[model samples]
Every structure is written in structure tokens, then in C-alpha cells.
Target: MALPEGKMDVNLSNTAVVLTDPQNDFLREDGVAWKLVEESVKENNTIENLEKLLKAAKAQKMKCFISPHYYYPYDHDWKFAAPLEEMMHSGGMYDRKGPLTMEEFRESGADFLNVLKPYIEDGETVIASPHKIYGPENNDLILQLRKHGIQRVILAGMSANLCLESHMREFLEQGFEVAVVTDATAAAKLPDMDAYAAAMINFRMIANAMWTTEEAIEKIASS
Candidate 1:
């Protein structure tokens, strides 16, 4: 099926790839949140698709922004913890634990995937200051994007219904044209909930457009 017209003819020069929570804590097998989303990731071929998107964006010389999820010792002091926030702490998801120590964050299961390291480590990719919570409001992401003259964002990453959706909503509200790469993201499947399915409904209803990694790559090439 064809996607909406104007949205796919994106201006890569003014566009940025806003990848939310692409760290090992969400993507690697040994990471804390892996168990919850592993099946979905594999089923959706998310890792490979994300690689294609990132690499393609790099090839196009498009700006890239990474919105990583990180939890500090101070975060544990939040007066009110949402259900997911509580779960994140209880399970040590993205937990840095100590303020001065980043051992955990730099270690095996918390770093960017090996396949994605080159693109992220290229020095051109803007690793936006980690989001203290779930969205860009708590981070420097928007400022970084704005500084780079980014007017549109191509979003993709882990936990489809949570961080990805949160980033998309915030980006849209901030007046940035946003497109979600559907196959580049996956979501947790809990006992009674399907996060991916839920996120898909919202994406279709809210995002300017939703594209598969292949379609996004093709669009970028044409642009």
C-alpha cells in the first residue's frame, strides 16, 4: 500500500533520525528488559531493520539523534513512580545505580549493539543527553535537534508503546514533522497486554506517516 504523499518526500537536510532507547538494556539478550520484548523483536526483525535505517540515514548524510533512557541514583527518589517507572527501578532496567559510576552503562549489555556501534560512534551522530525519564522534555534532545536545524524526525527504537510513542507525541507537539519506522521498533508483551499492537493503533492515528524500514530507506534514497 502507498503511504501518504508529502510525508515521504522528506527533506533529509532538515530531518533527523530520533532513535529512542536503542541501548542494550532494551535490545540485547542479557539486558534487563530483553525478556519482555525479545519475542517481539525477533518476530518483527527489529534489530536488522533498525540497522538498515541507521546505516541508510548515515549514508544520506542526515543528522541523527539518540534519545537514550537512563536511570540515576537520584531517579530512585522520585516522589511518584508510574507503574512502568516502578518496574524500571525494581528490575534494574537502565539503572546506573550510582551517580558517579557509569560502569554498568558502559558494560556489555548496556552499550549500543555491536552492529550499530559504527553509526552511533561516528562522532557525527548526536547522542542527545540521556532522557532522565521517558521523553525529550527531561532531556536535551529537542535543543540538539533544533540546533542542527532539524524540522522533521524519523523515529524508531525499543519498547514501541512506551519510549517510542512518548518521543513521537512530544516531537509532534513540539512542531516537528514525525514519521515512525514501524519495522525498526518492537514492544514488550506482558501477560495481558500487547504493547506493539497498542502502539500501532496510536501510530496510525497520530503520526504523520508510518513506514517500514525498507520504505524509509527508499524514500531517503530518492530524497
Candidate 2:
């Protein structure tokens, strides 16, 4: 049996680049989860590819939204956690001292990648409330997109098997056309799991379109 093949109708006026977890904890070498994701990140050229997408968004004047992940002190007190949540809580991964405090927030694990900050902080990009889980269901991404009349998305960013993949699935359910920039996302590889491989399969099975950074940039430029 063959799955449906889909293509995106790139309309910048009604399309936005939705990036998930483009933060230090996922992209930087010193990040808490770096060791776990390093191989996949390097294998996919994830960081450089993500930067390419960001640069394209800027050059094309594309609307952009970031769905970040963050955990304040009170978050640690939750009565239960999923496996990844346990891993995140164990070492204060993506931890911000407090919801209202920026104390030591600069250059922290939760901060956006420094190289990508100019575009994200340009006073135009919409930064949604931090999602506590793997998807945007807990955040305001859909609302933000709707407010701007965005019905299609160019999706990219960190931890392919988890947050990014989760975001893709949610967008589909929410009626947004999602095109994943495959190489711009990566996942943690463990002794017992090849997460990135798993995610690639799902992306193929799901997303309306699967594009490389160059392809996405071209579409955006022409859109």
C-alpha cells in the first residue's frame, strides 16, 4: 500500500516557520543533553542546517514562531513523569530558576541558541509560552499562528523524535499543513535506541512535505 503524497502550498502571508526547542540544551556542545544527541546531531548537520533555515526566514521576511521548552522550580515537584521527563528533571535540564526570574537565564540551558538570537529576538518573531511537554498542546502556538492567519508551517528544530515530531503530529490534527525540514532536526541516540531513525520514518509517514534546508529556502523565497 502507498501512503498519500502531499505538497505544501507555501503562502508566506498564511504560512509561518514554526521552530521547536531551538535552545541551548539541544544545540550547544555543553548542553546537558548534548552527549545523548551528539551523534545524531553531527550526522544530520543539524545545527548548521537550522541556522540556514533561520537565515532564510530572515532573508525572506517570513513570519516565525518559536515553541521553547522550559521548567521552573515548581515543575520538579510533579507527582509523575514520562521517561524523558524523568531524564529532564534528573539534572535540571532546560531549567530556568523561576518563571518570573531571569536570574542566570542568560546563556543557560533554556536560552535560545546565541547565533540564532538576532532573528528570534528581532521584535517580530512570536515566542510562545514554553511547552512543558513534547508538543505545542500545552503552549499557544496554534493560537499565535491563527492570530496571524497562518495555516501552513515550515517546521524545524531540535530533538527530532520527541518535541519536533510531536509538534508535527499536533499541527496535522489542528489542520495546519506542516512541511518538515528534515536535516534541521535531530534526536538523541542511545545504546538501546536509534531515535533519529525512528523519527525519520514517522516524518515520511506524516508531514505534508519533507524538505531539506535548501528546498525550504527556495520555496520560501518564491512564496
Candidate 3:
């Protein structure tokens, strides 16, 4: 669907793909976030669709920004950890246990780095926004986008109702054209999907358009 008040039909010619928290903690079958959006994660072929989208974006020579979730060693800071702590204990997405600390979890799962290594090696712009809160975190996302002269952003990643929504709102506030790829974004889980859908509906009503991965790919290809 078209963005409610914002412009439709963005010029992908200079658009950037801003992947939000596509980490093992979010995408892997054993991921905490996966448990939340397992159905959509599976049904939407989230990983596969993201790969396709990434490939298409690369083929078009679009800019790419990766926003990976990372938590420093300290007390609880993530917003969703309270109830999750009692319910899932250390099994939740933000919880750390065993030999792997939260920082380690982030480092190991930042495979997107490897995926985009070639581009970086080739002198392409690769922005990394780490330890970012929903959207208000003092990350380098905005600065990187401005440095690259990027105006349009294609968002994809986990927890559609949280991280994705936060980034979308921030981007919109910054006056950037934003597009959320539904197939690439997954909610926390079933009942949560309802919330996710509602948030997307609200997002569509204000910030930017929400399109399926296939539609996003087609638009990118056409552009």
C-alpha cells in the first residue's frame, strides 16, 4: 500500500537498504525473537526474502546500512526484557547466558558484516548502528545517511512492532522516505502479530508505505 500522507513511488535510484537487527538472536531458529514471530518468520521466508532483497539492492548498486542489536555488559537496558525475563528467563532474545555474553552474541551473529564485506572492501559505504535503542538511540544512522546523501530507506528485519517500528518512526521524523518490507519483517509471535499489523497500519497512515518483499524487489528492479 501507498504511504498515507507521504509520497508514493520513491526513486530507488539513490535509495539505501537499512537492515534492522537481522542477527542470529533474531533470525536463527533458536533465536529468541524467532519464537515471537516464528510463523511469519517461516511463512514469509524472512531469511530467503531478505537475501533476495539484499541481492536486488546490491545489483542496483544501492547504499546499504546494517543496524545490528547489541547490548553492553550491565544491568537490563532493553525495553522488552521485564516480562520476558520472568517468562522466558535467560532464554529470551535480550538475555545472555552460558559461555556467550550479550556482546559475544552480537559479534558472532553480525554475519551481515560478512555478507556485506565485499562491498565494503570495494570501497562502498557500509554503516553500522550498534546498541541502538528502538529509534532514539544516539547511533550513527542519521549521520551516515546524511553523509551518503541518502534520502530513501528500505527497512527490513526482526521484531516488526519494536525495532523496525522505532527505526521507521525515527527515519520518518528525519524527513527521509521510508518503506517497510513486510515479508522481511517478523513480529514477536501470534497475538503479537496483531499488534505488529496494527503498528504497520498506523505507520502506513503516517510515515511511509509498507510493501511485501516481492513488491519491493519489483519496484527496485523497475527503478
Provide C-alpha RMSD values for all models, in order: 2.4, 1.0, 4.5
Q: What residue pairs are clashing in model 1?
A: none
TM-score of each: 0.92, 0.97, 0.78
Error of 1 at 209 (Å): 0.4
Query: Poorest 10 consecutive residues of model 1 by lDDT?
Result: 1-10
Clashing pairs in 3: 36-188, 36-189, 37-188
Cα displacement (angstroms), candidate 2, residue 116, comes to 0.7
Shift of residue 220 alpha carbon in model 2, Å: 0.7
TM match of model 2 to true structure: 0.97
Model 3 agreement with the true structure over 39-137: per-residue lDDT tens digits: 767877887777888888878887878776555435344456545443433554443333244344433543443443454335564756564456635
lDDT tens string, model 2, 1-223? 9887768989878989989999998889999899998998898888888888988887888899999999998999999999889999997799999888899999999999998898899999999999998999988988999999999999999889899999999999999999999889888888898999999899989989999889999998898
Indicate the TM-score of model 1: 0.92
Per-candidate local distance difference test: 0.85, 0.91, 0.68
How much is the lDDT of residue 80 in candidate 3? 61
